[model samples]
Target: MRIESVHATPGVSGFYFDDQRAIKRGASQDGFAYEGDPVTEGFDAIRQAGEALLVEVELADGTVVRGDCAAVQYSGAGGRDPLFKAEEYAPVVEGPVADAVTGREAEEFLANAELLEELTVDGDRLHTAIRYGVSQALLAAAARARRTTMTDVVADELGTEPAAEPVPVFGQTGDDRYVNAEKMFVKGVPVLPHGLINAEEKIGSDGEALLEYVEWLVYRSRELGPEGYEPRLHVDVYGMIGELFGAPYDRDEVVDYFAALEDAAGDLPLQIEGPMDVGDREDQIDAMCDLRAGLADAGVDVDVVADEWCNTFEDVRAFVDAGAADVVQVKTPDLGSVHRSAQAVRYCEGTDTRAYLGGTCNETELSARACAHVALATDAAQVLAKPGMGFDEGFMIVENEMRRTVARRERDRSRAAEEVTAGD
Candidate 1:
């Protein structure tokens, strides 16, 4: 089968893009939007409607495969690409991108994805969002051509088995942390709420607020969760802890605070993402290494996740090789192609670092579902339920996709077994 045509369209994402620098500098929230000018270059407002480029590739058989190109919620920070404007990118996709894939064989997903990664229009590689979406479309197109599931295509190419069951889905609660967390416990989400404690105030001047919040999370999980429902408590502090204690992350105060957090959680597993953003990649890794070592020495069981400055496959490898993080969040958009994300996840296979296939809430359902297939194929430790902060919508999209894919694959395997038995 061959690709008949390729096209691009502008669309809106599930969430808005916020200037991370502005937010970090205390941009006040005004209702759903931020109430200040953007501090990041390329951003017009502190918060703007998230944009996505919809890549649609039509096969010769009239089947259409889709993928959404989207950036992170906090674009233009942490060494990520600039804000994704669908309008500006639509022409590129329709012109050079379409030309590249238009008459190509549709069954070679890995090769096509690699070509797209190295594809350049004007002496510059395509944006991460473009590569991400185009790779997703190609993967789906390959599956359609082979009449197999996308999971199967990925597993075959990577020499890994597709997950027999759904990967654990982690949910994030925008600012409605308490109510949404209760909802998560009730629903038996394997990973509880990502308490978005980004600001200093949220962490408290002396770090009391975060401690209080962790205690509350433990209490509510026990009270509301189903029997045998001990979910991992993951929170994205966005470097507030680092801010509160000030650098040299292995300090006595930092160790004591993490110990306190662990005690508060009782027995629930706790992982903190982006504990500090020191504005440099090497420094960030060094700090995380110190913090992880300190926690281990103090007998604190909290896991430190690396997010900021860990934006690419190379960065993930650096962290894994150095033993800098307990969990390395493979932020999908930041890595450019979905296959790169898979490689990053696989890179952590025998290492102490666990790969959390995570992406921003500022994405589309198509992108989120595509990531679901990647997580299952790579056997990531946990996959994030995302596209929006609304606890239910994002969760439903990702969880359902994984469940349906697994079911279909299992049914196929059973039917093949039955056929073999009949042949015998």
Candidate 2:
């Protein structure tokens, strides 16, 4: 099948983009907005509405496939691309992007995605958002052209088996940690609340606040969670732990503190993301390695997750190669093309490091759904439920999409079995 035309539209993302640098500097939250000056170069304000560029590719049969281009909530931090402004990028999608894919064979996805990912405009690569969304549309187009699910398209191209069941979904609790966590326990999310403990105040000056929160989280899960409910506890500190402990991450005190956190969580598995930023990628990796080694030495059963400096595919490899993290987040948008996320996830197959097929709360339904296909196709350890901090909507979209894909694959398998019986 050949592509007919391409269209682009500026739209709103599910969440706001915050200047991570400003937030780290102790920007106070006033209502939903922050009261501080923007610290990132492209950010005009400390917080602004997130934007998405919607790419629609019309196939030859008049069927249009869609993808949403979005950036992370904390853009321009951790070596990510600058903030994504949909209005500024819509023209690029309509012009060179459209020109590149138009009239090309739509039945194959990998080559087209690679071509678009490497395409440069004005002596620079297309913004990561553009590459993300366009690649999603192309994947959808390939599935449509072949009369298959997007999951199957990805699996076939990448030489992997599609997941037989839904990937475990991880829920985020934003600032409403208590209430949203209740929702997750009730819903039986495999990974419980992603406590957004991103600031010094949130984690507490001495980290007492976080310890208390972990204890409460464990207690509440037993109190309200359904029968046989056991979920992993993941808290993203955004590097506040590093700030509090003042690294040389293998210090006796730091190891003791992690042991305390494990004790607070009782028996539930614990994973901490971005324990310390440390400003540079190499330094961040070294710090995480030191922390992991320390935890092992102290016999603390805690998983250190690498986030911050691990933005690109190369960065993920670096972390995985050194065994810096127990889990490495394959932040989808930061990786540019969707296939890269799949590649990153599969890369962890033989390593001690596991892939958390993660993205931001700022993505759209289209992007989230596309990632659902990727997660299942790659059989990732856990897939983040996202597009917003609100627990219900993101979970429903991702979980339902994976369920539906599984149902369809099952139906196909049964039909093929019956056909073989009839022929025999």
Taking all chains together, each candidate's TM-score versus the true structure is 0.98, 0.99
Candidate 2 residue-wise lDDT, 1-424, digit = tens: 9998999999999999999999988899999899979989899999999999999999999999999999999999988999889999999999999988899989979999999988999999998889999999999999999999999999999999988999999999999999999999988899978889888778888889999999999999998899988899999988888778875243567788899999999989999998888889999888888888989988999999989999889999999999999999999999999999999999999999999999999999999999999999999999999889898999999999999999999999999999999999
Candidate 1's C-alpha runs over 4 A off are 247-250
- What lDDT does candidate 2 reach at residue 328? 99
- Model 2 misplaced regions, further than 4 Å: 247-250
Worst 10 residues of 1 by lDDT: 243-252
Worst 10 residues of 2 by lDDT: 246-255
At residue 201, give the lDDT of candidate 1. 81
Give each prediction's root-mean-square deviation over alpha carbons: 1.0, 1.0
Tens digits of per-residue lDDT, candidate 1, 1-424, equal 9999989999999999889889988989888888978889999999889999999999999999999999999999989989999999999999998888889999999989988999998899999999999899999999999999888888888888767889999999888999999999899999968888988888898999989999999999889999999999999999888878865253678889888989989989999998888888999988889888888888899999999999999999999999999999999999998989999999999899999999999999999999999999988999999889988999999999999999998899899999999999
